[model samples]
Target: MPTPNQAALDFLLNRRSRPAKTLTTPVPNRAELETILTAAARTPDHGKLEPWRFIVLEKPALNRLAALVDQRGNDLGIDPDKITKANAQFATADLVVAVISAPVDSPKVPQIEQVYSAGAVCLALVNAGLAAGWGANWLSGWASHDRAFVTEGLGLAEHEHVAGFIHLGTEKNAPPERPRPDLAAITTWVDA
Candidate 1:
């Protein structure tokens, strides 16, 4: 039988993401955020490609991005409500770590795997923050996929894109636990 850490399992089972909107000030300091990022760096990487990087955003950067989002939305003729919603994330975030999916050129490791690794890093960062007693949430909106926004706003290269924005801060209020997916309905048993 495989050994299991009960505490870790319990934490995995009960861990819930706090809404970014509910996050407040008194965010993690540089040293603390670095510790969390270090923990996140342990995500699985195929071919050792290390196909991701983190961009820490403070108030100024976040505000600039929010303005960029508004401009891009207007340029693209996007819905006002949607643009407002997306802008709010950057406008209100106490701190954000933008995970960039920068896939490395690897003969053995496929591009999809590299992208998945980047996504893993995002989740790891969020979980690490929550474990460290901070409120964290992973968010990506339409602007993430917009070429103009990704290129000009975040300065992502052609081969790179935003996997997610990990928002971290103190929780202003406890969020109610939402209903979970039906595991039995989603699970499939493969038997010979």
Candidate 2:
């Protein structure tokens, strides 16, 4: 059997995401955040295309994003309830890293793999924060999918899209564990 890291395996088994609302101030500082980002960047890239990037949002920028979300939601005729929910997240955000999926031109590396890499980066960022004793959650809502919001609020390019918005902060309270999936039901075994 290959040598295993018990602590790492234990963390993986018990890892739970803290809800965004429960996340408070005291996010990762510059050097510390850089460590997390570095961990996140260690995702798989088939062709070294590195088809992803991170945009860290502070309080002021988050406030501006909230306003932009409000405006865009109204302009796009989204329901008031949905608009309110979307705007609220930005308004209350302490700090977030916007995971952007920017697929590059690659003859062998497929676009789908690039997208998956971006997603892995998001998950890695979340786990890094959690392991460092901070609350972290990955969230993406209607705002992420809105082209106008992505361009105007976040300044993302035409080829870029938000894979996830990873919010990191101090934990307000330890949340109870929710229901988990039944592994047997979701698993498939085949020996061909």
Candidate 3:
């Protein structure tokens, strides 16, 4: 016999990310968000490298980042439409947690494993937000991958990279149920 957390399993079965643009004001406060971050920090890490960190982007920081994205897009000769979309991604959000993949050098752990740990943190954060009754979406775009944008806007280290920007806020509208992957199509059974 196995003990199972039914509530957690139910939440996982129904969890869906709300659209970033659809999230409104009334985001989690510092203490509340700290709780969510604490939950996110519980993600499994190979070698315990702890390769992930969070940057909470409040409204003012988001606004500044939005402007920086515009400038960087122009400097890089990116399409104007892309610039606008990315700018809106930041400008429209009330709160975001930037999951920074800060991989540390470890002989026991490969760099790719550290990177995967960071990615796991991102998903954990999104799930934490959702479980806490806040709408959350994990996002990343051109600005996140642009060196100048991350270095100047977020002050990331040379080795650190953005795993994702987990946007969190009040849900304006419940998103419709989207199609999920077919288990049979993607699953494999092995027996010996």
Candidate 4:
């Protein structure tokens, strides 16, 4: 017989991500954020290749990013509505952790595996923030995928990419539970 951790299971089952727009000020401070980040860094990293890094973006940095989003959107001739939404993502954010997927060169570990690790880190970060009593949401927009924007704004290397931008703050509103996938429909029992 195995002892089950009910608290952990309960949290996992009931956890909900607050929308980025619904997040507000009073985010975690440096020391508090360090604890949350430490939890996030404990994710699985096969081959010991830490294929991810975190960049904490404060209000000033976010403002800069918001401006850059506008510039990049204009330069790329993106839809005006898209630019406004993307700009608001950064402009209104008080705190965000930019998960950078920096895949290491390893013959044993495939690049795809490294990318997956980075994505896992993003999820871990969001979960960590939520566990720490902060509203958290994982976000990625057109600016995150734009090479020029990442290069100029975030100073990402050629091999690095934006895994996700985790917004963290106080929750303004509690969103109603949305529909969840049916596990039975997606499950496959392969007994070969």
Per-residue lDDT of model 2, residues 1-192, tens digit only: 999999999999999999998988888899999999998898888888999999999999999999998999999999999999988788998999999999999989989999999999999999999998899999999999999999998999999999999999998999999999999999999999
| TM-score, every prediction | 0.97, 0.98, 0.98, 0.99
Question: On a 0 to 1 TM-score scale, where does candidate 4 land against the true structure?
Answer: 0.99
CA error at residue 172 for candidate 4, angstroms: 0.5
State the weakest 10-residue window (summed lDDT) of model 2. 39-48
Deviation (Å) of 108 in candidate 2: 0.6
Name the lDDT value of residue 110 in candidate 2.
Answer: 88
Q: Summarize candidate 3's per-residue lDDT along 36-101 as a digit string, tens digits.
A: 999999999988779988999999999999999989999999999999999999999999999999
Candidate that would win on lDDT: 4
The whole-model C-alpha lDDT of candidate 3 against the native structure comes to 0.96
The local distance difference test score of each candidate is 0.95, 0.94, 0.96, 0.96
lDDT of 1 by residue, 78-99 (tens): 9999999999999999799999
Q: For candidate 3, which ten residues in a row score worst on lDDT?
A: 46-55
Clashing pairs in 2: none
1-192: candidate 4 lDDT, tens digit per residue: 999999988999999999999999999999999999999999999999999999999999999999999999999999999999999999999999999999999999999999999999999999999999999999999999999999998999999999999999999999899999999999999999
Error of 1 at 50 (Å): 0.5
